[model samples]
Structure formats: C-alpha cells, structure tokens
Target: MAESCSEAGLAPPPELARLAEGLTDQARLDGVVGLRPGRGGRRAAVLILIEVGLDGPAILFLKRSRQLRHHAGQIAFPGGGVDPTDVDLVAAALREAEEETGLDRSGVTVLGVSPAAHVAVSGFDVSAVVGWWHAPSPVAAVDPREVETVRMIPVAELTEPRNRARVRHPSGYTGPAFRIDDWLIWGLTAHFVDGILELGGWARPWDESRTVEIPERYLTDRRDTSGDVNAH
Candidate 1:
C-alpha cells in the first residue's frame, strides 16, 4: 500500500488519488538516497507535474538543450537548485518550472512533497514536489539555451511493456529506463518514473533483462565544466 502526505482537505483528482495516497519519501519509493563522503550539501527540487489528458494521466518533461555543459540532450522534469529568495523547496520547484517551461503556476495545485533524495553525482539533496495540472496553460520551452522541447507523455505509453527497458551506463550503473520515439529516459529521472508507475498501479510487467547501453550521444565528458549531472 502507498503512504499518504496530501494537504489537509484537498482531494486530488481520481486519476491521481492513488499516487497522492502512495506518495512518500523517495527512499521508500526506491529512489537513490545518501550522499557519498566528502560531497557538499546542495539542495534542489523538481516538479512531477501530472495532468489528466484525453488518453489518461500524462507527465510533463523537457528536453535539455544539447549545448548545455552537462546532462545535455536529456529529458528531465522542470527544476533546478533552490533559490535563497524562495520560501521553500515547493516554491523553488514551481518557480523553476515556470521559468523553464512557461508553466502557469496559478493553474497548478501542489499535492505534496516526496522527501529529499541524495543525488551523488551532483552532490545535491533533491526533492520531488507532486502537482496536479487541474487547469493547464500553454507550455513551451521558454529558453533555447536551457530547454529544447516540452512534451506531455501519457502514462499509458510509458507503462507499455514494449517501451520499457533497463539502461546500462559505462560506469557500470544500470537502472530502469523508458524509450519514447528517439528519446531515452534514464538515470534518476527514470527511477522516479518507475516508482510513480508502481505507486499509481499503472505498472505493467516488462523485460528487465533486456538492457541497452547509454548511447554515445547522451554521454558527457565529465572532465569539462561542472554542471548539474543527469536529469534531476
């Protein structure tokens, strides 16, 4: 059974009730946690924004610009490091989403927050803020330098067995992955998506043994400029 952290008196839409109820700390969701020794304590947050579309519940994702120094050409949720002026992680998430994708903050209803997860590669403690797009407004990549595309992918397509697989990085790291057209969703982002599927009872049996290596194009030269590592 999923745990609940919903705001008092706010009822989530039926399509998201399960997820809202099941929402808990990322560690319980099987997300990456615990920082490596000697890592700094930087904080960040991401918005896991969902909406009920014609097909069903869909998630918002943005493709990072290939020109970025790190995590280039990768699909990620709209987010970034917490700003000092922001009241909390939730505000940082909404602000980042709005800046990256032109998301109308007024239309989003924050469900709750998933406890922070330690992203070792980036040395940041990141939180996932769940939200419902009850009244979605026009969204697009507001900056070509940071974001290249904005896509709303249906959960049905993501849960399909044919689109699910495991991905192996050259570092010997292997984890859940999802393939949509030519885009490969992997790393921490994929793990969160996988957890969401299971939490919402939207998961389907898939071949875990079927794995693919991270494509050369998606691999970054870590020796260069330091920036946010794979999707937050």
Candidate 2:
C-alpha cells in the first residue's frame, strides 16, 4: 500500500503545524502529573493520533469492550501495558494502536511524547505519544475483545458548551468531561484530551460551571472487579 501523506491528501492541522514549528522538548514536561521518578509501576504507552478531517483536526479515541476485566466499557486511547520485547514507549504506543485500531504505523508521523502520567488504577506509568496521521488509514476495532468502536472526535465538537462538562468522581475529584453521543468520556481520558486541546491552542471558551457525575454504575462495578484499583 502506498502510504504517503500526499497520496492520502493528508496534512497537519494549522494549530499542530504551529506547535511543531515552535515546539520544544520542555513542552512535554509542563503540566503533567503523577510523575513517579523511579520505575516501580508497569510501563504503558498510548498514541494520541490526530488527523485533519473535513471539518478540521480531530482526535481518535476508542470505546473499550465491556467484557474486559479492567476498565470495562470505558473510553480510552488505544494502548496497554508495555511488553518486555517493546523497545520504547513510542514503539509500544504504535504497536498497541496497530493491535487495537488496525492503524498502520507507517501512516503516522512521530511528533514526540508527553510526560509520564501515572494511572494509579492500573499501577502503570503511561507516556502518551502524540502523532500526526499524515497518511491516513482505515481504522476500526480489530479486536472484539479489546475494542468496541473507534471514533474521530472533532476538536470543535469537544469544545462546544453543549458537549462539555465537569465530571465529579465519588472521591471528590473533578475533571473535564465530554458527551459524545451515548458515550460519556471521563477520567484519565478526558483529562488528557482537555490538556491536549489547550496545548494546541485550539481550545475555545466553554461554560465550566456545567457539571455531571461519573456514572455510579461504572464506579461501583470497578470497585467490585479485580481489574485495577482506579479506572484509567
């Protein structure tokens, strides 16, 4: 397959292009959390795949399969715990993307990585690798056991007041949330998405006063399951 940006008519979005032009390594170190300096927790990596769509630039997300033991039925980036054979975080992210979304790694341009964020629930430190899909590929749920559906959420739709809200956790933690159709994206996924939008300077002012509760069912079920202590 001819995997080239020109062949696919794909180009980086304006905001991303600007960031890439002015981007410094220090940008990844800013505003990151749970920075466990040592290496005790499991290592994991996720790809933040951005592409220029008809409406504009959008990000790719996945709805995890409900049948999974951990973080079931949750919205997450396509990633998992890094295997011993994985060379680095970027390789792990790309491998997981290919496994979960059928995304061709060759079609993606490595933009860099964000600081390591700890997922306390899974006891894993995840590094999010930001990438531009210069040569787009057909993305779908390659594994029914891991992925439920694939979504390319437009940046504009996410920043809209009607779709934005704050999700309150039972633990009294509050963070950004987005309502995309029937799916409610909250937790770590929402936090990462919110940060990325701001970093790209593509975020718009929305009513932050709007609030919603993270579904009790999700919280309760996760507590009962042995998957992980926290919902990633």
Candidate 3:
C-alpha cells in the first residue's frame, strides 16, 4: 500500500547489486528510434529511483497529476523531457529528480545507464538512469503542478517471481513484471527494471501466458502510460 511504502521510505535501504560487468547479454527492449523526424532537438533526462533502507530497497516513482495533459495518474519514474541547460542525460536526470521528488542530488552516485527508451505514446526519448541515494531523505512535494504523489516500492517485492506477468500486446514484443501491492510495474518501467535485476543475476524465467491486456483506448489517448504503442 502507498501508506506502508511511505512509512518504510523513512529508513535507510541497502545497496542493490550494481555489478554491470556480467550484464552483456541482458535483454534490452528496442530503445528510442531516430529522435523523431522533425522532433526538434534531443532532450535527455535521467530518471533515478532510490531504494532507501525501508522495505529492502524502495523504487522512487511518481503519480502524475490528473490535470496533466499526458500520462495523467499513471505510475512513472521521476524524470522528464531533457533540457537545453542540462550538461548531459545524467545531469538532466538528477535535476529532474530533485524537481519532482524533493530528493537532494548531493549524496547519490551514478550506478549505470540503461538503454534509452522512446515512448511511442508521448514522443519522449528517455534514458533510464540508475543510482544509489546515499543520503536519502523524505522528498517533499516540490512541484505540485505535475506530480500528485511521490511513492516508493520495495526492491525484493518488486523482484519477486510470483508477481510475474508476461504481457503480450497485439504487437510482437512481450514484457515482464512483478506486481507489488497496488503498483502494476509493466511496460518500459518493467523492461528497464528487469534490466537492473539482470545486473544482479536475478533474472527469473516467467510464463508467456501471464497477461494484462493494455487497452486500445490507451493508444489513441496519446498518453505515455504504457511507454510503447501497442501495434494492434
């Protein structure tokens, strides 16, 4: 529950295995395509989730405000469209994390970078960046306009085998997830989350049948809720 995760969010979490050397053959989803034809310039950003001490390790996720134009009320990693002032994707990620979660960027270390993801739904060429929040703290509600709720989910729970769901869209690609509590960790977040789990040699084989039909309506809405377009 969000209530429980918040309580656990107050404590110090342990370090996850950031051993990147063994992940050479990791299953990576086809990342962003050519920054879009007239998609203007590249806006890179880092989306870092901290697994503070509570509940093993907690992933920092955001519930976007319903008033927002895209992906309203969906659970997502706290980063955004890259900015011109950003030094690189890492800087943009940290900067965006601070703006969205109220977590200070001073103590966190850049672990590694995941393959860049282009959300077919929202036209965002996003790079999922992983980090360890060395001095994690309770993130105050910073910009209320975009973020409605800032929450964390457990590392162990999210990595559990039982929550496995193999989602096959009308498209050919299939993805996996460990649905922890109320959060359905699927789509791009699930894909990259699995990549991180692979860095720990924790990849568990999941059934191709375990399913969740992402509605067709989600596509036409043009929201980044699923991060990819269902090629129906």
Candidate 4:
C-alpha cells in the first residue's frame, strides 16, 4: 500500500491509517493535557488539524503576524481566547480555525477533544479539538492581521532526528523543539505537537543534547512568562 501511493503521488503513506486509529483511542486522549487554568480563567481552544498528505499524516500550523498584540511572530495552532457568544470550547476552536485559516467546518471530521490545557501568559484554558480533514480544502491566511502563514507539515519530516532539538529561554526554561522548513516550532506549540506524536506512536529517536536558546530580542518584547509558563 505504501509503495503504490508513493508511486501514484496521491494517497498518503500507510502510517496515516495508524494515526487516524491512534487518535480515537480513549487512553491516548489523557496524555495531552498541559498547564491547568487558574480560578476565573479565560477559556480557549485549538484545533489539532490533521490530514493525510502524499507521504503520510500531516498537521496544520499557523504563524501569527508581527502586528498582533499577543504572541506576535509566534508559530501556534489555530486558536484564540473564547468569545462571549461561543457556546463551548469546540465551537470556539472551529470558529477560530475558520477565521484564521478559512477552513470550512463541513469538510472536517471532529474526532474528539483532549483535556483542557492552560496558557498562563494568555490566561486561557485551552482544549485541543482533534479533527481529521477528510475532504481537504484550500486554506490560507484569511486575516492578514492575525495570520502570516499557513502550513501543512508532514509528520515524517517532523520526526527526523536532525530536525529535533531543545529550545532554552534566557529565563532557564527548556523544552522540546523542532526546526522544519524554516519554521521554529517551540514553546507551547512544540509541547503540544510532541505529545500528539508520542500518543500516536509516530515519534522517532532524536538527539536531545542539541539545544538552542531563544533569541533575546524575541523574548524581550513578548510577555516575560518564560520562567512561569510557555507563552502561546
């Protein structure tokens, strides 16, 4: 099956099937929680957008524009603080995905939601709403002010040992990191992706000895929560 797809340049690799199956296991959902929200915390959610690419399973990520008041120039999942009119976390995630990436909900198959995680810098209790883009659609940075770029990153490439490293902040905080196709995936986004790869059994052995400190210029302007929380 993998060989035929590689030849045809159409179907995804066989691992995509395993990924879809792994995502639905109830036990796997428990491993995704991050920081916990504080009392009277703001609510938020993110869509773990998944799709089968020509090679294997892929994930969608967004680059926030430099103009944004919060998390400017950061790579993050499509999500935001909840709006007053939204009914729940899932709705908020879907709404933000549509607004940020021009994704139509009808083409997406929502698998399930993971436990809510907290973003202390943003003060949001975020839930990961895992979804499969069964019928993939054209997506872009619909709102230029919010999103700078939209990318569908192949899981196989991400698992490459050379592409993995650790990112350290000046505040002495350190965590898993990934550098793929010119984008540096770190902070909360890196942790979230790492958890999914582990639970889905797609993770590969990588050298953890290699570490890169986040640039002081990057940290100087953003919320100084590097020691307390991974800023989203």
Instruction: Give all TM-scores, in the order shown.
Output: 0.87, 0.85, 0.73, 0.82
Off by over 4 Å in 1: 1-10, 24-40, 221-232
Name the Cα RMSD for model 3. 7.5
Best by lDDT: 1
Clashing pairs in 3: 12-53, 13-52, 13-53, 43-82, 46-93, 51-58
Q: How many angstroms is residue 18 displaced in model 3 relative to the true structure, after the best TM-score fit?
A: 4.5
Best by TM-score: 1
Please identify model 2 stretches exceeding 4 Å from their true place.
1-13, 21-28, 32-40, 221-230
Residue 161 lDDT in model 2? Answer: 76
Clashes of 2: 1
Tell me how far the alpha carbon of residue 134 in candidate 2 is from the true structure, in angstroms, after superposition.
0.5
lDDT per residue (tens digit) for residues 16-82 in model 4: 5555465567666555554343345566678888887667789999888878655577778898767
User: Candidates' lDDT values, in order?
Assistant: 0.76, 0.73, 0.57, 0.72
How does residue 134 of candidate 4 score in lDDT?
A: 67
Worst 10 residues of 4 by lDDT: 1-10
- lDDT, candidate 1, equals 0.76
Writing each residue's lDDT as its tens digit, candidate 2 over 1-232 gives 2222344565556758754542344654456443233146777778889888778888899988888866677888887667888888888888888988999898887665766676555667677777888778999999888789998988888887799998877766677899988878887677677767777777788889999867655674233234331254
lDDT of 3 by residue, 1-232 (tens): 0111123343223255433332233343222222222143244455656555744566677766667655555556777666787767777788877887777776566655655655555566567666666666778557777778887766676666677786665555566655666656556667666666666555566665778765333334334443222111
Deviation (Å) of 67 in candidate 1: 1.6
| Candidates ranked by lDDT | 1, 2, 4, 3
